[model samples]
Target: MLRWRPWLPPLLPLLSLLTLLVLSDLTSSSPTAAPTETGAGWSPPAPVNHLTCYFCENVENNYICNRFAIDHPCPAGTTFCRTLHIMDTRGGSVVVNKHCATEDQCRDDRVGCLQQDHQKTCVSCCHSSYCNEPVPTNYSNAVRQPKPTAPTRAVKSAGAAAAPRLLLLLAAAASRLLLLLAAAASRQLLSGSRQL
Candidate 1:
């Protein structure tokens, strides 16, 4: 018991080495470490929650449909793809619009008969991604019909959230490594003092 100080000097280095080894194992074995190595230069995209719809609006005789192949990301809370076809006064003016629609807007197909013109709007809702690629033909007998089952296009996966977590893990590992090294150095100094 009187010479406990000398024994402590040797044990300190052993304890520090063991801690370093354990920390190395933890850092390497962490799940986030693998992705961090591979995705070093890459950042994940944001999470996609909105539907991309083909949007076009044209007046009759313009036949300007598809003029712009714009992929519109619908506003949040709007989950369905919609196609609206309108006929004005015996096709005098026809307008078609494709866009993201809400559930209420896609409740049913509506036809309005005005004094000088008849307007027919076909509302269709689709749950799948980019399901409104094709324009709707029948607007008069509208119902909330699901698009036919077909091969769905692959959506881009977003990885924006993962990068930050990986960075935090790396920081933690580096800090732990630094602490271990400091402990080892202190142990060395104590042992040297005992020799003096």
Candidate 2:
């Protein structure tokens, strides 16, 4: 025996719409998805591919690092080549370190040198190969260069960055709408079944 219920017709449209929404969400690719970490404290950059840098650390002489720098491939998540030069103002000792670094490591460093209590630290970051070979110079009060601009790479515009956030917000709103519609439809079905 086959029985056709009148209440089921209204739910068909709602079920179809819900299925479509779910399918669309699953199919559409999201640009703002969280990136996989390569290793400890390493999130790969999107702008550049593999980078080769000079790796060395010397506490005595700045020229020794540049003279005997190892051409090393950067790690998966490291994007910039960093050169750190620390000068002890009291003892007149210079420490030079050139290695592959992440963006966060170079975030606070600027073009000119920064002086602390008794030591002046200068950190310079570059994107190209062997860019960190040149050791950072000592602090000079006369040289006041302007803030260095971002590296020559594809920088996302404000609108482009906001687009992903907007998509997520819309998706959330759609989900809430679907839940409310389902609840309303269920209540309607319950009342209709009770009457009959």
Q: If scored against the real structure, what TM-score would every candidate get? A: 0.40, 0.42
lDDT of 2 by residue, 42-104 (tens): 444465456898788775666777778787688778878888778787635478888887877
Candidate 1 Cα misplacement greater than 4 A, ranges: 1-47, 59-63, 88-93, 109-119, 139-141, 147-196
lDDT of 1 by residue, 1-196 (tens): 1232445555655766775665566556324322345666544444466577767666342245555657657777787777666655554436677777787776643322223236544445676666665544454333455644443332222355465567667666766765665566667767778999
Error of 1 at 37 (Å): 30
Q: At residue 19, give the lDDT of candidate 2.
A: 57
Candidate lDDT values, in order: 0.57, 0.67
Alpha-carbon runs more than 4 Å astray in model 2: 1-49, 90-93, 109-112, 138-196
Q: What is the alpha-carbon lDDT for the whole of candidate 2?
A: 0.67
- Least accurate 10 contiguous residues by lDDT in model 1: 108-117
- Worst lDDT window (10 residues) for model 2? 139-148
